[model samples]
Target: MTDPYERLRAEAEAGRVEEVVVAVPDLQGRLMGSRLSVPYFLEEAARGGFGACVYLLATDVEMDTGPGYAIDAWDSGFGDFVLRPDPATLRTVLPWDEGTALVLADAVWPAGPGGGHGPGHGPEHGPEPVAVAPRHVLRTQLDRLAARGLTAYAGTELEFLLFTASYREAWERRYTGLRPAARYNTDYSLQGLEEVEPVARRIRRAMTRAGLRMETARGECHPGQYEIVFRYDEAMATCDNHVLFKDGAKRIAAAEGASLTFMPKFDEGEGNSCHVHLSLRGTDGTPVLADPSAGDGMSELMRHFIAGQLACLPDLALLMAPNVNSYKRLQPGAFAPTGIAWGRDNRTCPIRVVGSGPSLRIEHRVPGGDANPYLAVAAAVAAGLYGIDNRLPLPPEHTANALADPAVPRLPATLTEALHRWEGSGIAAELFGKETVAHYARAARAELSAFERAVTDWERVRGFERL
Candidate 1:
């Protein structure tokens, strides 16, 4: 068997592929590039990259032109950005778009005109920076780690709620009265999984076929919610797998005549969570943060990473939970952290220090399943690096209810607060470039503004007759 990479290279070079999909992640983490014929991919895109509008970064999840963006406006003409395909990431998405191999792309600035010979826009001097793209942000943070002679590996526990209703049926019902695959809380129950087995089986097989490494699958605290854990890989690959797996899962579930949502707090029952587990290793392949003799077997480096997360959580909250509905899931006692705190093997804390030896890592629980893994992971890495660079002290682990402790800083209680923190955050700006921070913060504000103008059923029912 030729390893996957060799197979991809052979196929790409030999023109054996049909549709070569070049995908670049937008601010919302949605794959936002286009499908090209293999000839165009090989001739134009594989090296030179295709052109796309830069406003893709500014658009909200609703596709509304996001306000307050510093670039790509009516005045600026929404200039073209280069979608630089990374051929190394080419792989067949067998379960969904079979016969089509997809390569992830980086957003860069297009050259002046005909080919690379356009005046000053040579290979060495072209404007290739994608300052607002999430992948670029993650890559920047990863490079920071590399500069320290360290590499970070991360694994995410992806959770989503499965409903018996088909997507159309659920939408017609306005997401009401859809049967949960399970009838009660089924956390870690083998029997509980049986209830959602068909949907689960389809998802598992799809992800497996797509080459997503499945580590474990289990039920969560809610009736129909389940979590699939993947093996940890380097930060870039981990986040890439996260996005691909999620897109694959949605497609497979819809195909199976079932529907699932990663919406945090699908009603009041349970909020889907993507708990992140991360560890650092030296460039030489030795673990840097695990010391057998240290407290909880965590090196000072690990503690600093945790400390960094604690300090930066508020500013990064909007990036982790981009939507307004996401904050509703941050309620206390919902298996989600409400404050910035850490504990040894504690689920209640924002950062949970767990395992020992080769497994020594911290599980960051701040992000919802709705998070764009690229941004979330990037924020985590940036915060970790900040902690290391600043030599910030990791506070004593919290043994009590973090929400009840007034001393403990709360996770930004709303998107508004998060945007405020994000705008003023020196750490976040320093971590993920100031311009990128401002761009995303503007998008978040736009999302918030849209939410506020809408009158929901609850609003009408509560105030229509009473007032």
Candidate 2:
């Protein structure tokens, strides 16, 4: 196998690569970074790292920053954080964008006096990773699991709705009355996908060229909605591919003169979901999630892992459901999860155990499309660790529809409730340091503030006619 960096260097020398994008995943899982010239990237940035605004990690969807965040960019003069590119994430083949290669980066505080890349800063100085950054938050959890001789493997199934109208048109119309790619429900229908298949095919092919292994792709229940699942990998790599795919998919859609949305609930119909499938393995690659000797093929470790999810789902809800729109999809009858229960092959339950032997894993159904993959996966890993450390007993599985069972404990019903649970729970602080909890709590509060201050179309239409 050719070395990824050497291959990139050769491509740059041959004029086949012009730019290298060094990006970091923000709180919303959006990639934010700079595009460097190939020569500059291969010479300087790749060795010493690239600079990005610290606010990238502190801001909300609108890029507004304020106090109360762990980073507190405004108070700190909105300084810069170094974006250290990870060689493991380098992608040399981007079929969608020619002459461009992309690499995911980690946010780190600058070295030397006053935590700035000032005088005395040298290659010998070690920069500290930003603890509250989304990538680091996930890394912390993975490190915790590793300490216990376990590694996490995961895959995410994300769904989105595609529209025939271009993004510019969708924006001009205030995102209403646009034409859907499909006129009706086309779940698993090979016939009606002609409208969406063209753009979908481009996205699928581009992702494969970008190094993601495609597992499945098909239409979803809602009109214009589609889902394409990729094969599982190490937890961190899975999330890296997820963000890249999302970013590339939008660019591809724009080039195709179409628009798609991954918002949890676009309307009253079926909503988008990001069901996370997770399993545990030993450091040496031994699968430990299943035991054939057990009647159900669930290992003792697997039982505790499921137990942890039930115990911590409420407290960690904010991580999985980060936005107010996220709760709109989690409501009952929405085909998303509402109750905190686990069952074998149960879609209605928040935690569903499936597969057998090495394939055995727990599927967490709480997150919607709006979720930040790193944070959501981190919550799952942390919850499972909690269960393993305490040896929490697995509760009886709800064989029936867990969504309709009033007896089953419910997940946080709203972002407000989720935030309250997350901030108040000592378990959340323990699992993901106090700084991480407080940082995300502030983010959720920012989202709520933004929503409260806006007068929506629904409110205007109702009052415009009534009064």
Query: lDDT: which candidate is best?
Result: 2
How far is each candidate from the true structure, as Cα RMSD in Å? 3.0, 2.0
Q: Please, what is the TM-score per model?
A: 0.93, 0.97
The residue-by-residue lDDT of candidate 2 on 201-282, one tens digit each, is: 9999999989999999999999999999999999999999999988999999999999999999999999999999999999
Specify the highest-TM-score model's number: 2
lDDT of 1 by residue, 56-157 (tens): 877888877744775554445656777887765777555677667888888876654532311256555775567778888888889989999999999999
Superposed Cα deviation of residue 318, candidate 2 (Å)? 0.5
Clashes of each: 1, 0
What lDDT score goes with residue 74 in model 2? 75
The 0-to-1 C-alpha lDDT of every candidate, in the order given, reads 0.82, 0.93
Q: Could you tell me which residue pairs clash in candidate 2?
A: none
